[model samples]
Target: MSPRLLLLCLLLMLPVAALASVALGAASLPFGEVWRDVVSHVTGGGRPAQITGIDDAIIWGSRVPRTLLAMVAGAGLAVAGAVLQTVVRNPLADPYVLGVTSGASLAAVAVLTLGPAGLLGPLHLGVPAAAFVGACATLALVVVLSRHQGTTAPVRLVLAGVALSYLLQGATSYLQLRARPDQLSGVLFWLLGSVAGAQWSDLGLPATLVVGCTAWLLLHGRSLNALAMGEETAAFLGVRVHALRLQLLAVSALLTAAVISVAGGISFVGLVVPHSVRLLIGSDHRALLPTTALAGALFLLLADLAARTVAAPMELPLGILTAVAGAPFFLWLLRRDRSAAGREV
Candidate 1:
């Protein structure tokens, strides 16, 4: 299928997926009623008839925010993954795999527990700010450590990112051990990822980041394609390879930070969604980027639905769910690549 056609189909599917997400929760409202309620609420009309009581609250107050968060986080992480893969020229590169989200997680945990309010005041902005700082700092450190002479080797970059991820995680674990019993659950939940506590007000920054970063990425599609071919080739194409890498790293860090801030440490959306889109639509970033964003949003919306419903009233963490799904896919990709290499040899 044409990438544009695939993207259009995915774009059309998003609203359906969203509607299902909002409707298929444990409460089990009629789709028509759910639609009416949503339309009424969005249009600033009164609550629709016969949809009164807890269902109304469930749809408008709880489910809407949670669903929106899933969409935003999923899209942002997927686009980040697409950018990282192109920037690093590694199929396995992702925010989680490369330690970007780990860095963001560490910073967010610190801010939530240690209280950076002394400097930032509002915790909402402070957490994302702290996470963005941590992500960018981690990316810089990874680049510096991974560089041999003046050039970044992809394998070395991955190794450095993995090492840094472990170090950051170890520090986070130590802090977790010292956390007050009352605060422990909060810390654990954030680390595992959830959007259950989402509020309408919390949607602004992540949504903006996803939209803005995706637009920026689409604009640089040709450069991304060149970079994926390698820095030498990209530079040969007048792509300013080093500058482009820096730009992508910064944008990816910012997008990842915005996501982890609100949704906690949701993983694998970045890793899996982009690859899936690439398989379906090929690797043109112009299409791959936007389609990946939509697929990510849909995948996470469905995953959130599973997270909420599979355990009944007890919700599983979004990160755990994605890891469960992503790990096998990762192994499969590795095995397939090895087999392909063996065939070539």
Candidate 2:
């Protein structure tokens, strides 16, 4: 399909997905009633009639926030992936390549095991806050280390991230090893990730960070496209390579950080969504940004929907579903690449 048509189709799917998100969950909600409730709530009519207490709670509390989190997290990740790929000029670069997820995981685990904030409280304090701090600190370290006497070092930056990831992973593993059984369960679940515990109160912070960063990214799409060719080439085209580089990297990191704060660690939305959009809409970042946002949001909402409904009352960990769904698809891409390369060879 043409990009125009594809955009419209994806846009249409957004509302449909949003509606489906409301309609289906662990509760046996009648679609009609769910829709009526949602429409009433959204249109200012008030809560729809409910047959039971649980249904009222499920429709109002759980599903709305979970679906919104999925949408925002998915969009944030997809944008982060696109930015990382452009900034690093590596097709394989995704938001998590920097080991942001590792840092977040470590922080979360620490919160779970031993902290001033006990169990439930620290889960809020120690996890998300520590994750964002880790992301910022790692990037600062990478930026400082990636520079030599005076020059920007792309390979150095990437290598530094890889090394840092392993180091952080080691720290995270040690925490897990020493935790009490209850703490271990907390740590394990955080590592797995889910939107099961979402609340409307949870949306504002991550949404602001992502939406702001996305707007910034969209504004710089042209520069990003030029930069994709190479820093020197982008410079030749009158792009301020360093300024733009720092800006895009900051935006990507922030986006990754925000989503990781809520969802824990969702891998490959960044990788998968961008690649999928690029195939359909081509590589113009302007088109790709919005397209990726819509597609990514829709993709994740559907994934979350499946995560909720597929297993029914027992919720599936979203991380497991995304990885299970994404990893194979990614491998297929790799296999295709090998086949093409083999033919060429």
Query: Which candidate leads in lDDT?
Result: 1
TM-score of each: 0.88, 0.91
Candidate 2 error regions (>4 Å): 49-53, 116-124, 331-345
> Scored by Cα lDDT, where does model 2 land?
0.79
lDDT of 1 at 279: 64
lDDT of 2 by residue, 34-56 (tens): 77766777898666555355775
lDDT of 1 by residue, 1-345 (tens): 688798888888888888888888777788888888999999998688778868888898888888999999999999999998888777778997678888888887787677786324675447667877777788889888988988777778789999999999998888788778887888888898988888888899889988998999899999999888778888899998877887898898889888887888887888889887776677888788889999899888888888988898888999888888777875675566664324421
lDDT of each: 0.84, 0.79
TM-score, cand. 2 vs. native: 0.91
Residue 100 in model 1: shift from native, Å? 1.7
Per-residue lDDT, model 2, residue 65, is: 83
